[model samples]
Target: MSWPEGYGRLVLAQVDSTNAEAARRAPGLAGPEWILARAQSAARGRRGRAWAMPEGNFAATLVMRLDEPPEHRALRSFVAALALFDAVGALVGDDAGLALKWPNDVLLNGGKLAGILLESLGPHLAIGVGVNLIAAPGAGQVEPGALRPVSLLGETGVRVGPEAMLEALAGAYAAREAAFVTYGFGAIRTAWLARAMGIGAVATARTARDETTGTFETVDEAGHLVLKTAKGRVAIAAADVFF
Candidate 1:
């Protein structure tokens, strides 16, 4: 199939981590933007954890070159999240029980519908996204409080085809990329916060060092989750928050 302007081509494989495959192919590719994968055998999420990807799930990775400085890299995650949110929302419904979690997670009715992983590949970056189209895998299952994972078909009673989802994602991503390049991360930041799952609610997060319980503040311009704890406001760069 002929890919859209921003998207070069969709490379589908039976199995392999899209992020890992994209990382390996990024150096030899001519352009900076291309998507690869059909399913992931060993998908990964934040904190170097594995993301379960069974058949019928949507697994893909987008490779792109950013002109922005290193400090602004987090904007890419916001953009990717916005794209997935918009695409999935359009397919299901505006109020399709969809919400964007901090960093890059797509939640449906308070459960995880999709998750994104962004990794640096030399001068380029690979943004990997996994969505539960039919069934969600039962690996790396976390606690059941706030940050629980859900699936698309499980929520909407509608089976979203992987190819269709990819098309929508590519289109949404292209539009968001153009806006990010032209207007900067301000626009994306505003939209992301608007679709955020919990803004002023209390949440709990665990990191490698310690655990934090605080109010969910707005995501800062740098894409860090700003939390208001008893001591003071702390900017969390990486941590899984339980809403």
Candidate 2:
């Protein structure tokens, strides 16, 4: 599919933190939807963790200036995750065992295939994404699963290029943004829950103060994970979920 107009002037580089670089360039950039991509990376996910971006992996960031306030900023991360899902699903097919984990992680056959990170740079938000297109690196392993983080080429035996995936993502993000604008967060929430990994599964949530075990319920409108614990329904804004 063709990319949206004015979204293709990507700044390609050999190495840099996609999130950092995007944030640095966001203030000076006149366009709202500019992309930055690199062949390798030195930075990783949440909490300044380390992520290994090999030559074959896809590391990119898109900077967007939204009209909404900071309280609703989390919606951009959801949009980014859904966009990445659509892009990877298109290359590997819908039945490729792709699913979305809450707060922004893409799973393929119950293994992490991609991760989304969102950072706010003043009024603009930089949405960074890393996808395992060829090989899954071990430097940033978080958990183990049956699939062991299969890539697009490994799962489908097809080499998917980074440019093509970025184009697809841009299109998907446009569609998602349109839906969010017209119908509000309800539309995206439904789509996200449909492909959610732990919506109906029993899982453990590790929060800062306490850890709770409960069955995963649907995400609320404000973008919090609603867990049905033995005691009652708990709305968690931040936590690590494990099954």
Off by over 4 Å in 1: 1-3, 143-146
Model 2 residue runs over 4 Å out of place are: 143-147
TM-score of each: 0.92, 0.92
lDDT of 1 by residue, 2-44 (tens): 3467457656676568778777777777775556566667778
Error of 2 at 240 (Å): 1.6
Task: Provide the clashing-pair count of each candidate structure.
Answer: 1, 0
Q: Model 2: per-residue lDDT, tens digit, 1-243?
A: 887765635657765687777777787787756565656557668657677676767888888776668768878778778878888787766745888888788888777888888888888888888888888866336544322566777767879888777778788887887788789888899888888897788977776688888899889999988889989999888777787
Error of 2 at 140 (Å): 7.4
Q: How high is the CA lDDT of each candidate model?
A: 0.80, 0.77
Residue 98 lDDT (model 1) = 80
